[model samples]
Target: MWASSARIYAVALKEIKQLSRDRVTFAMIVMIPLVQLILFGYAINTDARHIPAGVVDYTQNQTSRALILAIEATQAVNFQHHYYSPQEATDAIIRGDIKAVLILPHDLERRIALRSNRLTQDSARLLNEPIGQWLVDGSDTLIAATVRSLRTMPLNDVTQSALPQTPVTFEVVQWFNPEQRSVVNIVPGLLAIILTMTMILFTSAAIVREREQGNMEFLINTPIRPFELMLGKITPYVFAGLIQVSIILLVGHLLFSVPIRGGLLSLFGAALLFIFASLTLGLVISTIAKTQLQAMQLTVFILLPSILLSGFMFPYQAMPEPAQWIAEGLPATHFIRMVRAIVLREADFLVLQQDALWLVAFTLLGILLASVRFKKKLS
Candidate 1:
């Protein structure tokens, strides 16, 4: 028993020494928890405030101006754009430029006057008619609920008019996923999360695996270039990603009734771009990581931000601007936006060309980085 205890101590000491030398693994150990703590404690917020919104004000009168200011004072929303028409506001929502739109009817003043005029026996229905309504993007349930809370709220302090006890200042009209089904949003976002996990994981360990399995020396002697080798690693996974997408989307549609409303070609095209981008990104990781364990650590480092900041588990708009900027760098963020737009809103492909171009540029840059890094490492 004494000898056994001594051997155990020997092995433990060696492992501690080895761990100290493995800087990447040690850094991951420290950084993972630190990053997670920072993200969860500070970056994530459920009670989203200052959400981006727009206004279509036909009144341009005191009531309208006061109403806008009153809503702004709530800090629930911040109106950044003043659209001329409701159609323009709808288009802006579709483009994801704003989350909700406050539409003030041209006769808002007259309606408020009717509400105040108890002297004449005006119809109760006219008095109760909502002063305005919200056109909300319900793809994000939290943001929808946030905006919905504004419905039936009394703004008498700002309106300076005698309002009903239950004044519906703004009725909310949820655009996509009107039923506010959580699954509708979750199903589409799953595609981004799943692909991001699989595509990157598969290739992040590509070159690392080769080195560990004793194939690196054999390949180094060959004529195959680093770019060609990286492409070879990515091509198979491209097909794998496609298959995964089909399964997720089909299963989502059949099981949850999550509609696939966009054109198949455009959807497929976006998926292809994201898959390539993710896979090449993995290749870059393969060159950076010295082992499979380290490769996986790096992938996890990526996924936390992807899950939190990509508007998957939480509302993207809810996060602080710094978090959003970090999220914008993740490939999953762009894919999630495209998938939701295509599947839920049925947004035209042209409307989403900007995100598509971003993915294209990301894919190209990833490929180049992976190739250059692999070449340098090989030399």
Candidate 2:
């Protein structure tokens, strides 16, 4: 018993010393928990307020203005853009520019007055009518639920009483997800996450694998350009990423009943750009990390933030400005927005041009950086 205990203690001590020596792994051990705590505690907020929304006030009258002000006072919706038409507002929603839009009809005043009277006594016409309409992007289940719950918005100027049940302030029309199934949102988000995990993990270990197999020195002896080498390493993974995408989408559509409303060309185009970006990012990590273990640690670090800040788990509109800015930098954020736009809204690629361009730029920049960094390693 004493001998066995001594051997166990010695092995434990050796592992502790080794862990301490591996500064990257040791640092990751400390950083991962700290990052999770900070993100969950300070960043993630479920009771989301100051939601970005648009308005299409067709009436543009005193009553409409009052109603808008009242909604703003609730702090649930912040009217940022004023659309001339509901179509414009809907396009904005599909493009993910805003979560919801208030469309006040030309007869909004009459509707509000009728609703005010109906609060005292029930009438069939007033019961069926809505003062205004809320065109909501139901891609995010949480935000949609919050917007749906706003049945009792207090109209102070026209009517002092809150509208409850039958004649609500605004009748919500959920786009992209009329059913509001969580699966519609999850499948596309899972696409982004799965691609991110696989592409980055596979390429992150590329150079380390070369070193581990004693081929790195031989490659260095040759006159292979760094950029060429990077292309060679990531090109295969790009095809692999596409295959993974196809599998996930097929399974999601068939098993989960997630709809593929957009053109396959646009979908695959976005995937291609994102795949290159992720793989190049992995290559950059491969150049930085000294070992396969460190490469994996770096991938984990990127993966965590990508999942949390990528609008996959939380509503992007709900996040603070700083968090939003950080999220903008993550490739996953742009990809998730693009994928959701295409799949859920059947949006044209032109609608999501900015995010598409960002992904392209990300791939180009990541490749350049990886090539340069790898060249330095070669030298």
Stretches > 4 Å off in candidate 2: 1-14, 117-128, 157-168, 375-379
Writing each residue's lDDT as its tens digit, candidate 2 over 1-379 gives 9999999999999999999988889899999999989888877777778888999988987787877887788788899999999888888888888999988899877666665565455444675666778889888899988888775565444456554433355688998899989999999998889999889989989877887777877887888898899999999998899999999999999998999999999999998889988998999899878789899899999999899988899988778888889899999999999998999889888888999999899989998998877752333
TM-score of each: 0.95, 0.92
**Candidate 1 regions with alpha-carbon error over 4 angstroms:** 161-168, 376-379
Q: Candidate 1: deviation at residue 337, Å?
A: 0.8
- Candidate 1 achieves a global lDDT of 0.87
What is the model-wide C-alpha lDDT for candidate 2? Answer: 0.85
Each prediction's Cα lDDT score?
0.87, 0.85
TM-score top scorer: 1
Top candidate by lDDT: 1
User: What is the lDDT for 306 in model 2?
Assistant: 93
